[model samples]
Target chain A: MIPSSWYLILSAVLFTMGVAGFLIKRSLITVFMSIELMLNAVNLSFVTFAHDWHAVKGQIFVFFVMMVAAAEAAVGLAIIIAIFRTRQTLNVDQIDLMKF
Target chain B: MHLALFLIFAAVALAGAANLLLQKHPINAALSLIVVMSSLAVLYLLLGAEFLAIAQIIVYAGAIMVLFTFVIMLLNEGVEEKTHGSRVAKLLGFPAVTVFLALIASIILSSETHLGKVIIGESITTTQDLSAVLFRDLLLPFEITSVLILIAILGAVALARKDEQ
Candidate 1:
């Protein structure tokens, strides 16, 4: 019997890695992937809690989260394409027109 | 057997995440994320979320990753160029994030939250069981998500289309 906390600990670790990638990486696509990683990590936590609580609602929440992630990815990638078209670069630093 | 399998997949997921961070090219990072997503699906299976496990694979690994790869191919993005980032970001960012996450991990481990053990192959949440709660108690949210997906599709097409001007 594996301790549920181990799953949570793993989730935390994965989420941390996602944050690190988000902070360190410069490319927009990779940064977007990092956001997905973080979402996946949270999904793992939701599943773990679902298992422990013997409730289906947690899994239901995971489903909703996945749905939102899909929608976000669709709109977000389109925005990325639009940005790439205008700025002609995927680097975040150079896309600082709004940075003032 | 369960513990061993858990360890193996967990290690694979962690490694894939690290690879996603380390790889400079967007394509390689995207591939690494696929590895992470697949291994996560396996983890979900081990946790007895069968519907979620399959959904994770189909939605994330199958559909989402293909979309990411497609965009990468369309853009023809090259390897990332190393830039001399701000001294604060380069020097303090990694260490700050490392310390913060370490704090969070320690808090989680040390707290008395009482997250019980997960015995594998027991108490599986079946697809029928899920849909019962989903379609009945959560019917409104379910319909709302359909609307959300519709809007997302429209938004994607609108945003990505070439401008007439």
Candidate 2:
């Protein structure tokens, strides 16, 4: 039988990559996607722990996370669209209107 | 048997995520994310989360990603421009991340024995139990989430349209 540690480890690796991408990528959409990737990695860890403990609460938590992610995505992308309309650019570095 | 399946899908998911990071075009990156999400759905199935697996596909891969692509089209932002790579990120960031990965890998591998193996259930019995818990224990949070989604939809509609003076 495969140990649950493997799944957890993979989740860690994915989470780290998401962090790396979030820092390394400049595009707003790519950064946004990295956030989703991070969420998915967390979901994987939750499922791993759930399976190890034989509990359904982990999956239920994953459900809540997905719901929140969906809402975040809708609002986030709409904001991105609005930003692009005004600034005519999608680069987070270039779209720095908040910086003084 | 299951190990091989897990490894294959894990590899695909990892590769797809890597592709998402490296691709220059947002659309290409978005597609790679979809690949990652789909592979993750299969892994969820293997872990006995039958309902979550299907929901992962339907909600994340199906709806969220389509919204991303739609926004991409609506914005019409072309390929990402080259940034003046941050000097701090270059000198310290990449190596720091590598060290972080190594640290996590050692921690996980060293503690492997403490964590128990997942006993795979033969039948798809998770859906019924999941629903039971979700409905009975989590009904309040579930209703609040639906309300959150409604607010999000309204917000998106308001935000995406042309603003009036």
lDDT digits (tens) for residues B59-123 of candidate 1: 99888888899999999988876766533455878898789788978877886267788888898
Calculate DockQ per candidate and list them.
0.77, 0.73
Cα DockQ of the candidate 1 complex = 0.77
Per-residue error for B64 in candidate 2, Å, reads: 0.3
What lDDT score is found at residue A97 in candidate 2? 61
Q: If chain B of candidate 2 is superposed on the true chain B, what is its TM-score?
A: 0.88
Worst 10 residues of 2 chain B by lDDT: B117-126
lDDT of 2 at A26: 79
The digit string of per-residue lDDT tens for model 2 on A1-100 reads 6888889988998988888888888789999999999999999999888877778889999989998999999999988888888888888778766766
Model 1: lDDT equals 0.90
Model 1: CA > 4 A from native: B86-88
**Each candidate's interface RMSD:** 1.3, 1.7
TM-score of 1: 0.96
Model 2 stretches with alpha carbons more than 4 Å out: B86-90, B122-125
Accuracy of chain B in candidate 1 (TM-score): 0.93
